[model samples]
Target chain A: MTLRRRFVLVHILPIVLIGLVLFAPKARPGLRPCGALLAAAGVIELLFLAALARRKRAVEPATAPCDTVTLVWALLTGWELATSVLHLAHPVLVPAPENVFDTFREQPLVLLRNIASSLELLAIGFSIGLALAVLLGLFAGWIPRLRAFAYPIANVMAPIPAVVISPYLVSLMPSFRSASALVIVLGVFWPTFLGTINRVTSIEPQILDSARMLQPDNRTMIFSILLPYVLPGVISGLKVSMTTSLLMLNFAELMGATSGMGYYVQNSITYANYAHAVAGIIVIGVVVTVLNALITKFQKFAIRWH
Target chain B: MNRIECAHVTYSYEAHSRRETVLHDLSFTAADGEFLCIVGQSGCGKTTLLRLLAGLAFPNGGAVRVGGAPVTGPGTDRAIVFQNYTLFPWMSARKNVMFGIAQARKGLSKAETAALADEYLEKVDMLRAADKYPYQLSGGMRQRVALARSLAMDTGILLLDEPFGALDARIRGELQRLLETLCTGEKQKKTVIFVTHDIHEAVFLADRVLYMADGRIVRELPVDLPRPRADLCCADADRLCAARRELLGWFDRTETEVQV
Candidate 1:
């Protein structure tokens, strides 16, 4: 399919599923109006398709990686018609897209405070964990004695899922945030650690021989040779690590948290304000997408060798 | 007196997880400023012996020394140009040459490093590709860059492991001439160890030819032919061709023995 068609299909398919689900519940009175919501969603999505059609001549190949503006528009347009325009489904359950956008304006201070707190925790935890992992991984890879000690420990440690211990960690720690950050750290560290060790061990033997010929000491080996050698792999590793850290953070927040995007969802769910809950979900998706894009940009700049 | 000495040196590697000796008790000396070509049939450890001199590999027994100093590892005093993939693909030609200069001339200024690299690249007729990566160049061009990088190191000893072995015959002949002109015409001469499977190549460029069979240096043949040697029309070309024919006879004998 053309990307435009795929683009249109992406928005159209979800409303179709929602329509099918709504009509299936014949006895649910409030959901009868959901058919109208679905119809309006269909219309807005058709408009999106028409807009895409109008610019089809300018469109690049179907496989070209494009900006997310189209995706965001599709998401918001589907959402806007689903709740406010048609008043479909339960009154409390369906939050309007405008209401979600308003959530950002209404509680900007709270949003900023929570986001800042979460980022600070992530920066501290990720830096510490990543630094330690690289150092230890380099040591393990280069020296046989250290490898004997670390390799077994790493094998044992890597499989212990961070989420399983997070709740207990919350109880043990002074603050839930610290525990949550610890969970993120643990979640990111193991894989990166193991990956660095593998990268070091699997480095091109010729290059290793070249460095050995230079007779650089351990400090030079790690700093100049090994670090630069493994940098491309590490940058590639960062995308997955960032994702896992976010997953752990959200999971850790679900159990107990005062502030965060996760806590925002948790609090709204508790108050039975599904609108706020839905808003928080949208926010989390946007934030994660933005962070991932930033990481990709940084990755391109860092590994010009690639 | 930075001459190389190999005293009963041997080398082997594990093949099929079993010990397989490639070179056995090889003994030879390459004096300062001597261009010694090692000619042998394939798999005769000619390349292995060069690796020993370059300190890229350790001898299983005996010793390989340079100017009375034992070679424990590869050093700035000896720069090597292999038949293939010696230049780091990620670096540009200029940067590749600069890397060698940096290793050998540590205290030199940035401008000096750049100028010296350019001078060598110009010598190899590769200054036009100085900013290009290895992959961007043809096989012959890449070898020129490699040669430039090796020469820029200013090493007293140059080890060439069949440096043109991968090229087509025409390019190989051209580069052999380039190699001859570069090493011979210069005021400051270097001790060279050239390994090749081609006897003609050995005779055309070498001051002395060492023939090997079954991992041993069986004969040493000195050319003692005058300089400004040209393959096509030099006065001593007939003498070089005759020497090449003699080396080719040894290769034919080795082939017949293998067949039997």
Candidate 2:
């Protein structure tokens, strides 16, 4: 078969098999929701396939996305068969895909509220942590005495996981939100600070010479020459830093928070609402993926010279 | 006057509890508007001497003086183009040139500095790639931008440390001609101190050439070749050829000394 024919076969076989299972005679009453959910999913996949075929010329043939789409279809088909048709596993522990997906339609407002709360905390904590790190890192890196004093301290403190101190921070701070933000700041600050110091110290000697020949003052030297020289390294490290900070924030939220994506998941598991918990996990994945994409875009725009 | 005087300057690099002297009591002077080249084998301290002249480093003993003033540190009075990585990779060609102009001629508006950058970049035939970053450009193009930046600074003293040394032969010749024209073509010629290992380059571009070896000046030869000395078809071809041959002999003698 041609490559295009193979793509169509791979995509269509899974959809047809899934459709047969969805419209088959009902083996149990709760299976109705699963069938409805699978039917809707099949329609969505058809739409997606149409779109993909339209844009297929833009993408290289036989790349990751093609295989990825096929894999996703296979996963969904297997999941539907196990939960609805065979009833092979523990029912409550592995909730049917329909019920898991239906949590979105059933509790849209609740999910949105939790997501908004989580993102708000992430924005505040990330901004404060990154700004302080860059500012202090630049100063500590540039000055000899400051670097000598802080470098050893950062080496000692940065290795200690921020999550380890969250319980104490919660008790010490006036509010849980403040405690969470503090945890994230501490998590992000040390690594970024250390990286900045190393980068500033290791700037290419000839570049330093070129900047020095311009006869700039201390302020100009730190802000203009040193900052830009070290920016590509800093921006490259941002994705990792962002991921760690989010992890820290979520861990803090799990301790005793009233609302957040992490709190939502923890709360659901407490009440044995597996469907809602699964939905929450998927939401977190989507949020992180979107955030990573945004960071990649910002990196490209900021360091076009690189 | 734009004369530069190095009064018995001494320099050394201290690495891991050991001091290795690079320039030992070196002394030289270049009159105003002189195009001087310092040529020697690698590690013979030609670059160290240029760095001292550019005020990028300090002498352990004595001083480097420009126009009767002792050099303390790098100043806007002198602009240097290093062999490689001199252009800030973070900035575009135009921005790099503007940076130099802004430093040397303070109080100019943004428009004025930008215009000055354009003029110099145009002179070096790099105006078409003004917005290109150093990494995006070829080695020869980057050196052209570096030359543009130094010239745009409009300083009395220009210090070049093998500015064209990393380029291919054709591009090196092209830049050599550009440097010669820029140094001698202007009415108020700038004093230039160029350092290179290429003897032919020294003979072609220098009004006077200093041959350095083992941290000392081995010889100084004055080239009385005619203007626009791009080729050997001139009436002074024999003189130019004789000067080149004499420099080559010094290199051969140094190689024999090392072998012995």
Candidate 3:
């Protein structure tokens, strides 16, 4: 289906389900199943959907984030009405979406501090890892003997998952932040290094032939030709590395004495505050989205040829 | 002091699956300002001969001497134009010509180099597309740019290996006429070694035609044609027809089912 059609369908399906549950003739007080609040919810849901459909054509098909975002918002609103306003859900265990929002407001300082800590580690670790990967990858790819020696080692090490060794890594390092950053670095380094090698190897033959005819030395081959050829590929590989780096960072934060988004969620679940835990999950989603968007913009500016 | 002497040169290559011998005891000399065309069947070392002349490769035995000095490699003294892939795609036509100028005369400023490139592009009737890349140009236009680049170098010897072989017949005729005009217009003319399998093309253009078979020159037909030579309406047309017939007969004797 076209992106526009799919976008409309995503918003429409939830509205139809909510309408069926709350807009029937007997959805009123006493004699009705719930009250006028449930009927009012159906009207609010329909208005939210109409507003969404108005903006659907402006949305690009491949960017389905709006659809996902709208669905998440609508599902939470429905959950709120079912549990708190209508009293239709189980009493003690099921809290409304209002409780989730209240949980967010109650510990805003704690949440902000943890987010800052995680972001600090993420920025430092990813920068070091990506910079080292590019420099070493370019070196290994350009020279034959270096490539032959480094490629087999990278092949063996790249396939091992970075998350599996988090517990042991956490014990070995002096501080939790150091261990977490190291895990993220290891997580992001290998694929980018390997990708750079493949990209350098498959560069266009005509460009290489022209450089060879010019009889450029080894320094020129690496600086002038190989770097430009691999820049586009490296920028593209950043999107993948960004996600994998976050995965390692969060996993490492989950284990030990730490102040991070992962630790916040882990600590909240420990105290049986599921509402705070859910809010933490939402914060992580927002943080990752913003980080990826920044990388994407950087990539666009770096590569104009493609 | 004004000649390229190939003193009994020989070269061979190893195919991936077998050994192939291309040239054996090949000896020829091209004098100053002489246009020589080497015509032969495919795989008869015609291009290998031009490469040797251009100093792109070395002979397995014997040497190539330019002005009584042995050639080492591709120097500014000689410029080469292949059948195709001569221009770098990333560079525009003017830039390609300017690169030759920079290689030939390094001390010139960028503006001086650009002016020289523009002058040659105008001479070859390619100034309109001087800023266009190779991929953006037609095959004939790219060849014209290649010609302008080679000519702008103003090398002592111009080595063209089937320069117009990839062009269509109509464009080929136009470039041949352009080559003639360029060759005769200069006061101190340049020597040209053109390699082709077309008999009429050789007879129409060259001062001397060297026909080869089995990796050796078998016949030398001196055209002695006049200058300002147009492709049509010339006495050289009749001479070209006669030389074409003679070369075809030689070709048939060597291999009866011959097709280029």
Candidate 4:
């Protein structure tokens, strides 16, 4: 469909959401006061779509805004129909949108603290994991013996999911924090390390010859030439690594951690508060979106040559 | 003493578990301040010979020497330019040049490097595009930066492997003129070993042209044409015609005559 038609189709979302606010029956008792929240969500979604439609064309693809928002609207409408309006969903398992949105208003601190905790672990874990991979991968790739050793090792280790071993790692580590961080590290390290080593080995002969003609010493060759050459590959692979590690971090938190987005959901589920758990899921989605946006910007800056 | 010498150099590489020889016992020498061009058909090992000079590849047997000393490995004394991919894509044209200078000459401050980069960039008429990355620049523009980077290194010898081969006719002509001007217009002339498959280009640029075939020098011709080949290309018709005819004779395609 044309961008106009797709954008016009997006009006269904606010309509469905506003209909819930205005006409959703008091069919069930103990449902929260959800009029303001549902109305604000509908207005905000409309304003967001409007802003997206007006953004400069070069910033993103034209149909992305329309296609994605339409999908989100479709899902949300289906969800509201099943739980809030139709009253068909199980109350304890699938909370109404009214109850889910109310969880944000009731206890904002709990969610914020969990998000902060997740971000902290992600920052520390990702940096250590990626940095160590590139560092070791460089030497391992450049040296013959190390490359032979690393290539096979990485191949063997990379296919084994880090989640499969996280429970054991958690039990072995001294604390939950280290265990969770290790899980994130294990998730991120192998593929990136393998990628880095492969890129280093397969540098174009012409480029390599040009660099060799410069007669850089070993230090200059490795740090100055080889490192920069492999960097774009590493940066480009960063998104996949990031998403997976974040998944591992959350999974690790689900086991033994007291705080994190995963912990918030797990705790809410333990207490039978499906509303808070659903809110936590939405928060995780937001975090992933924001992180992806950041990595894209960094990719532009770091690999301009490509 | 020869400025550059390759004494019976042989080179081969293993591809798919098969060793293929590219150059076989090839031997040549170039004098100081001489412009020597090796002309041949594709896959005749012209680039391989040039790489041997640049010390990017070592001969399985025999040796390559520059300034009476054996070439053990690549040195700052000999800078090189390939047809393409010589300039690092991540760096801007200016930074690429700066990097060359930094590698060849140690302890130059960042400002000094920048100044030297701009100097060479201007010499190649690429100063405007100095801040642009290789991807942003056209094929010819990238060659210009590659040339600038090599020149900025201040190497005594320059090894070019069909540096203009990838460019179109117009840009190729422009760069040929630029390269000739840079070589002839400067004092303290550099010994250049250029490898190309273009007979006309070889005649225009070189004092001596070597026609290579079957992984060896098959024939040689000396060009007696005057300076500034761009003007000579139009003016000195007789000598230029005679020289290209001689090169064509070497290539065994006498019917294919090259115009000045």
Give the top-scoring candidate (DockQ): 2
Write model 1 residue lDDT over A160-191, tens digit each, in one string. 99889988998989999788878877887787
TM-score of 4: 0.93
Give the per-residue lDDT of model 3 (tens digit) for A7-99.
676666456545544553332232223333344445545755565566656554434555565666567557755765566876434545545
Q: In model 4, which regions exceed 4 Å deviation?
A: A1-9, A43-47, A54-64, B14-19, B233-235, B253-260
Tens-digit lDDT track of model 2 for A6-62: 677677857665675657554434642554465557665775576566665656665
lDDT digits (tens) for residues A82-109 of candidate 4: 8778888897898877888888788889
Best model per TM-score:
2
Tell me the TM-score of each prediction against the true structure.
Answer: 0.82, 0.95, 0.70, 0.93
RMSD of each: 5.4, 2.3, 6.8, 3.3
CA shift of B141, model 1, Å: 3.5
The lDDT for every candidate, in the order shown, is 0.78, 0.86, 0.78, 0.86
Interface Cα RMSD, each model: 2.8, 0.8, 4.0, 0.8
**Candidate 3 TM-score to native:** 0.70
CA lDDT for candidate 1: 0.78
Model 2 pairs in collision: none
- What pairs collide in candidate 4? none
Better of 3 and 4 by TM-score: 4
Candidate 3 clashes between residue pairs 3 or more apart in a chain or in different chains: none
| Kept native contacts, fraction for each prediction | 0.12, 0.84, 0.02, 0.88
Instruction: Give me the overall lDDT of model 2.
Output: 0.86
